[model samples]
Target: MSSIRAVLFDLDDTLWPIVPVIQRAEKLLYAWLKLHAAPVTERVTIESMRERRQQLMASDPVYQRDLRILRRTVLLEAFADAGLDTRLVDEAMEVFSKARNEVTPFADVLPALENLRSRVMLGSVSNGVADLDAIGIAHYFQASVAAHRIGCAKPDAAIFHAACDALGVAPAETLYVGDDPLLDVEGAQKAGLRAAWINRVEIGQDRVLPSHVTPDAVFGNLHQLEQWLKDNDPLTR
Candidate 1:
């Protein structure tokens, strides 16, 4: 182990439970859509909208690779198909984005991040289109990398390497913290960085470890992550 000059984090499930947050945001967006476009409301339910979005993405080869673009494209197509004005799509997306940002992180996130901030350079590497500024955590990161912007998503060594390059640190000296075992841990390891899994679900109990991507450490939450940082001599190589 060496002193951690930088720390990279994963967004979505790693920072907070994204599914519920997005669900709530979509609900809010749908409510707004109902008010603004009555005819569209008559034709599509939220569930159906989601299904159509999936179908549209499945039919498009490029969208199958980039989820962020797929999301935007899906929203546009859904609005068109529902006979809604296309101009409102951007407004609706903006509303949903703001609502998505109002998510409550796990109790441990802020305090742990506050503690680690002074100790190391922190940044985020996400596979989706999360704007850290929208989430009000932008100040905490020195850099934020998204897969859509980077042209490469996680599980790809290039993306991890790009993050490391942006940080001006070698991968061997950076520690990446993420929730997914394969995408976060294994991917980081393959890129030559130490990886820690934030296993909030307690699902590791019945799972056999995958051969290619073992995590250097695992934590139940940010509290455990802080403890790991303090206990380990990060400076010892």
Candidate 2:
């Protein structure tokens, strides 16, 4: 409403669905482990590996912010237990990272990005370790902030502030677009930026926000968000 000069996004679910991508990556990583570190595979399954990651993060919350470290640590520990060369952790991560970055954006994503970038500066702030450059959308954003790199995650405000600083805009003049109600909408609002919830499906179906959390706007697709921008900001219109 204050004439948005910049827009920051949450990468994983905002631009593209992440669950399937991670699932596929995990499958590939597990296959790779089975081939190279056979002993580790004998003791570990993909589901159990995921559980170990969860347990590790539960023990030391810092791993929740540093996903890469959490993943590598899990692999390293598995390698150690199996008496396999721990150096294979690097190769294992490379395999997973490559598979993880292969993302297909939502149908409305590219068209809306092309339209929005012409109107305002675009940046991304994500808690996940998604490689935007590898995903081939790096050129669309002026800045990309990852929680692991910034040492803070969303809902903390520092990650959002980092993105705004990188974009050379004040939080009040930026709109943060994301899919999560609490992590993205409430988090952005708490960080002093306007929040727009991008719910591709029917609302209150899969998830609902707390009674106290209210987003500035909500849309089903990026096209609607682009139109909202043009309607709200006359300069862009």
Candidate 3:
């Protein structure tokens, strides 16, 4: 086995439950719109706005890669459609971005990170706009690479390579841990890093793995992962 010298983590579903974060942020953004951009609230419901975002994501490749731009574009279009001043776009984005960064990390996340960091270099690579500083976990990571900043999303090897490079480690000596089988696992594997699937949620068997993509390790939580590394790889222990 390649001795693991560093570990790169996926921020969203791996470190925290992202569904609730996005849902709460959407509600907060809509509430802000209702107050300041009343005309926008009149024209579009929250569900409609979600549909619009999906449509915009489908319409362009950049939208799929950069969530902040996608959301700002949506707000601009909404304000323009309602004849509201576009200056409010920044304010509205602030409301959503702040809420989006208010994520609650999983219970096991900190402990695992503390244990793992002692044994190896730690960093993060995310496709989302999660701010590590805002989330209060910035100190744990030696590097944090986001797709928006790099102009490429996961499932593309560039983002993974960027994270490895930032950590001063070759991909062969690093392990990538994340929740998504295709985007995180397959992407890291293709980028030449060992990959571990962190299945925090209960996934049905049918939804587990793509036929051609198998993770080097799979665990239900980060604590389990730490234990697995200790049991399977003496170097990590």
Candidate 4:
């Protein structure tokens, strides 16, 4: 492992549990649509919208990386069918974006960031749209690379390389910490960066890790990760 000069993070599950945040955002978005776009509301519930989105994306996979465009396409199609104005699309997105960024990070996040950021450059690489700046943690990061903005997502080395390019570091000198085994650990490894899995998900007795995925290290939380970095201070290959 080369010395880590910069650290990149995955946004959603790695810092804050994302399921509830996204659910709440969707609910709020639907409510807003119902109020402002009654024609659309008459035909679609949140469930129906989700279904339509899946169907649309299934037929056209390019929107998978450009989620904002994907979502806008879904809304435009739905609105056209409902005889509503497609111009409201941006407003609807603003509603969803606001709710999406209303996240509370895990207890360990702020503290660990305060510790490590002064010592190393920090950046965010995420497939999600959550805005760390809106979430009030933007000060901690030097740059943010998102799938929608970068034209690719995790598991692709290009996105990781983009973050390293922004931070002026090589992949070998960067550390990526994330939660998902394949998207985070294996993705970082494939990108030629050291990876640390923040193993926060609780699993049942029968739960098992994917056998093919390997990580440079694993920690239960950012607190433990911080400690590991301290122990391996000036960490090197």
Write one digit per residue (lDDT tens) for candidate 3, span 1-237. 678889899988889888889999999999989888899999988798789899999989999899999989888899999999999999999999999999888889998898888998999999999999999999999999999999999989999999989988999999999988999999999999999988866423225677898999988889888988888778899
- Tell how far residue 69 is off in model 3, in angstroms: 0.3
Stretches off by above 4 angstroms in model 2 are 202-206
Ranking by TM-score: 2, 3, 4, 1
Winner on TM-score between 2 and 4 is 2
Which residue pairs overlap in candidate 3's backbone? Answer: none
lDDT of each: 0.80, 0.90, 0.90, 0.84
lDDT score for residue 30 of model 1: 86
Q: By descending lDDT, how would the candidates be arranged?
A: 2, 3, 4, 1
Checking candidate 2 for backbone clashes, the offending pairs are none
The TM-score of candidate 4 is: 0.92
Clashing pairs in 4: 1-237
**Candidate 4 local lDDT, 44-154, one digit each (tens):** 788887887788768875677877787788788878998877888889989988888899888889998998887889999998787777899999999899998878888
Better of 1 and 4 by lDDT: 4
**Which 10-residue window in model 1 sums to the lowest lDDT?**
201-210
Q: What local lDDT score does residue 181 receive in model 4, on the 0 to 100 scale?
A: 85
Please give, for residues 99-183, the per-residue lDDT of candidate 2 as tens digits.
9999999899999999889999999998899998899999999999998997888888999999999999999999999988988
lDDT of 1 at 31: 93
Give the poorly placed runs of model 4, Cα more than 4 Å off. 202-207, 235-237
